[model samples]
Target: MSFIARTSLALSAPNRIVETAGRSLAYRRFGTGPDLVLCVRLRGTMDSWDPLFLDVLARHFTVTVFDYSGLGLSTGTASYGKREMARDVDDLVSALGLTRVIIGGWSLGGFAAQTFAALHPHKVSHVLAIGTMPPGPMLKPPEPLFLETATKLSNTVADEYILFFEPDSAASRALGDASMARIAARTEPRDHPTPPEVFLRSLQASIEPSGPFPDPDDAYARFYRNTDIPVLALSGDHDIMFPVENWYALNDLWPTLFVVTLPDSGHGPQHQYPEMSAEIIASFVRHTAAR
Candidate 1:
């Protein structure tokens, strides 16, 4: 829990605490106007999110960002899976009495956000899926690498994973192998790696009976269909995680489904271009709400 709440001089934002999802989830609410839920990537907490980015979002809507259970400060048995996490989002909204929210997510978090909306369409007024894809072999080349890393890192602490998201600072990049060596020293949790059962449960929830979803070739059209709500997908051209090709394929399926790419951005642009990104999604929500 210290990772989510224990603040250092680096943290610039205040927090609003709440007990939801059966945990004392530390949520941060900003933007005094409409409601928006920021579904963070896997194993994230509100604090790990960049405050500068969130502050920008707060300017337009009352954004709700919380820790997913079993990560950071959120407490519970460390059982992991998308269904449970998606359910947590449902529980969070219901507990807060919010009937409508523009649910958005990043990476694995984005996948779950879309799934939550698809499963509970009535609750999600709008959807924004950033840096995600339908599950399958069609995903980016780096996905398999990421899976390998995830399987190896379940017992690791969040700090060790920071380099995956952080930009290559000149000072650090200049150091080359030495830089990664320093980053690698960040420790994994000593308790234990997540058990195979937890991983299996997560996999079952993420993929359908046949395989992973959106089927890349038809993701955009598919995601936009069966619901009248607006949808957007933001990605990066260099995203090795689920490379730009995946999103390009989605766009081909639904040419009208708006999409954007951030220059030099990898998987997390909300942190890199918070205000502009927030504006993009908030505008769509407002437009849809007016309609």
Candidate 2:
């Protein structure tokens, strides 16, 4: 075989191990038992989470994860926003024949999960929200450095880089430069979440732009109200993306909200403190179930 053939074989080999979502998603499931669906954030794919951490969660219960619409293995464009993406989650559950789910979303995904639970309370068994906030500018703006980094990276990375390549390493694939509109069309579909070209289009919009931008789904409400299901909201102590103070706002919205604060972590506590994250989740699930 030619050299190109050899290279293609090697790359596909690693990915071959991953399962497909028929025509609707490209997701992987590990372990078995009750269902726990992990929702990815805006501009996020499954790669945003660490494999070792997934393994830990898998040990306790079945875990299902997929690239959100327009982002990862699911086929589509990448620039979609909150309401559309939330629809994607509902479609994903229906497509996968998931009748009941413990929906967990981090960052944007976390907000999405709450939104989903609020929108479809019967389908959602419980909710786990992490490091997330509503749309629109903050009452108090983010710290200068954090805002600077976010704006800089948004413009530079081609696409949002959840797990950016190291300075010494080669840059991420070319798809990071996909356009905003193209990315927006990637809803959870009947198959792979996004076509690779669409992924590339989303990359284009990641770069910092000079004008107006879309906000996350929840711009008006601090917390989703009047839900009866169990809820767990966690925020990292040092997270600049969504400061821990947001938890207080969340608590105000839902008086009985279960809140946990990680002492020394950043925006992605699940990735940064997997053991703690997992244990906390397990406890929440058990406590929720017992109630």
lDDT of each: 0.59, 0.57
lDDT of 2 by residue, 161-220 (tens): 332211221322222222122233223222333444554455455422421123453433
Stretches of candidate 1 off by over 4 Å are: 1-24, 135-139, 143-223, 289-291
Candidate maximizing lDDT: 1
Report RMSD (Å) for each prediction in the order shown: 6.6, 9.4
Q: How much is 241 displaced in model 1, in angstroms?
A: 1.4
What TM-score does each of the candidates earn?
A: 0.70, 0.68
Superposed Cα deviation of residue 263, candidate 1 (Å): 1.7
Pick out the ten consecutive residues of candidate 2 with the lowest summed lDDT.
8-17
**Whole-model lDDT for model 1 versus the true structure?**
0.59
